[model samples]
Target chain A: MTALYQQSLEGLTRLRGIAGAMVVSADDGLVVAESLMEGIPGDAVAALAASLMRRMGTAVSAAGFTPPSFMHLQAARGALLVVPAGPDILLIAIGDRHINLGLARIEMLQAVEQLG
Target chain B: MRALEPWVEQPLMTFLTESEARLTLLMTSAGQVVAQHGFTRAVDIMSAAALGAAILSSTEEMARVLGVRPFRALSHQGESHGIFLSAFETPRGRWIGLVVYGQDTSLGLVRLFFDRMVDELMAGVPAEGGPKQVLAQNFESELHSSLRALFGR
Candidate 1:
């Protein structure tokens, strides 16, 4: 793994309840690097999250809003959080319901800065 | 979009919706068209199918000479557009897909959805008989008829 992705994923995985963190291509949804729990399907997560992000970006812009910087999808079992690292890259986190959103957000922002 | 085979329509449509591909062609490895989308003329479809099949065949032969397995897929990216070409197995036969995408979509997304579509197509294909044969004697007529069906001309 590249230092940028390894550092980002490693930092995100340290948080409690966080199942995985991945550096994904926003354009293609391919995982660049990941620190995923044993059962987590990183490829599916990256692809679906990137697809959702693209759809949401389109909808947001069509509603006269600027492109979104961050997005969250909370499910019954887990949650997905995405933040743009650059025009073509994304930082994504998968976590349980008890995960700390505030801390995760801060860590993700720092990771994005490192990516820059 | 139009499909010479009815079963191909739904899978092709689903692929288009998910991948956001601007143009797509699904054909046999032998260059016989089974379905197509976003093509305005018969000549374009025929040319693309022939070229795609030729490219895939030549690449496969090259891989053989190099003692490597044939490539799973090929892609070319440009400033404004990108093309993805891949071959997959089906109950019917091996099929090729040629996709053209723009800024709104990425190759990763296309490939992901394409894999799903292949699975769907494999399941959805009827198992009543062996694969259809495209004989040389009827090739031109079949091509013209398929084109007419696609364009309603």
Candidate 2:
């Protein structure tokens, strides 16, 4: 892994309640880099997250809003956070429901900046 | 979409809707068409099936030459469109799926749904005789018949 990718994933994975962090292709949903816990199903997560991001972008644009830079999906058991790293890449983090969204959001934005 | 086999229609329809594929063809390893969607001409479907089969055959051979297992799927992305090809096993026989998608969908989404479609197809397979064996002498006739059935020509 490149130093930037490793650093970005490591920083996110170090956060409390974070189950995994991945750099994913926004267009294809392929995993570029990841720091995942056991049994996280990284491939599925990456694909679903990218799909959701695409849908969100389309819906938001159709509504006359700019593309979203950040997205948070909170489910009953977990939450998924996504930040666009670039036009074709995304920074994604999966965590438990108890995760600190404020800290995670800030760190992810910083990581994305560094990645850029 | 039109299917040569009745059981394939539902699964293929589901895949077409979910994957947002602009064009799709389901065929056998021998290049016989089973179903197709978004193709306006019979000639185009015939060309795509033949090409897809040949490409898959060559790639499978390449994998053997390299001492690797045969690849399950392949994809190519162009500026305005993309193609995805994959083969899966069914109770009847091996089948291939060729999909063409545009900017409205991604390869990841197509593949994810393709896998699900494969599973559904397997589950929906009729518990009876296997596929009819196509003799080499009858291959040309079969191809023409399938095309006529699909296009009503």
Candidate 3:
């Protein structure tokens, strides 16, 4: 289980513009395992990503749409992509603005299925 | 205070009206609001700005530890509405965008125009002048005030 998490995370970072990746708890925002480069702060990502996920859940459920399968945040600097790796775990990816989002989405979905 | 303000206001208002978003806010990376549309209350703006800034700062730290560059945008999709947040740099300074939209618009639509908005904001809008990259004085103190405003403390 640990190896799977580590391997997938390490693999995510190899993608073009992908800087780091990690698996975190959606409920508690704790880091399970991470493949982070020198400057990326995985701990804070894990915590805040989880918190944001919780908040998004509230807004989503209140509105009556399908519970979000995942979430993405876009900015001028780069992109922060999160998807469910498991029932309670979130896969977080940080990439450059130039990163191919289409491919990143495919990679994340595949990783989730494989993890499942 | 910033010459860039006039240029962005019109475009942002247009985006909000055309896109039918509940709210769209533009702010300094330090969480200062430059312009906003579709908000009924000032407190809501203050809350959104603080949260947006907090999330961006934390995510930037996440990027630093990941040894990657930075994550520019973020989003959360609810049932009836969705939130899209992104950070970008301009000649004026680094800024962040926080958007809230309902079923009247989809995330993809907001995104499509948002990218265009950036292009519009940067290239189309001419900067009259204002000591490029100028930012609010005492950002930390201002952030504290925003938090106080948010909590009514």
Of models 2 and 3, which has the larger TM-score?
2
Q: Which candidate leads in TM-score? A: 2
Tell me each candidate's TM-score.
0.83, 0.89, 0.49
Per-model C-alpha RMSD: 3.1, 2.4, 11.7
Q: Rank the candidates by DockQ, best first.
A: 2, 1, 3
Candidate with the greatest lDDT versus the true structure:
2
- Model 2 chain A: worst 10 consecutive residues (lDDT sum): A1-10
lDDT of 3 by residue, B18-122 (tens): 556788878777665677777666677778887888788899999999999898778788878889899887776777888998865555456656766887788
Native-referenced Cα lDDT, model 1:
0.87
Error of 1 at B53 (Å): 1.2
Q: Clashes in model 1: which pairs?
A: none
Q: Residue B67, candidate 3: how far off, in angstroms?
A: 2.0
Instruction: Name the runs in model 2 displaced over 4 angstroms.
Output: A1-3, A59-66, B131-139
Candidate 1 residue spans exceeding 4 A from truth: A1-4, A55-67, B131-145, B148-153
Candidates arranged by TM-score, highest first: 2, 1, 3
Residue B64 accuracy (lDDT) in model 3: 100
Query: Candidate 3, residues A2-67: lDDT per residue as tens digits?
Result: 899888888788899999888887754667888988888766667656666767877999999877
| Counted clashes in each candidate structure | 0, 0, 27
Kindly indicate the candidate among 1 and 2 with the higher lDDT.
2
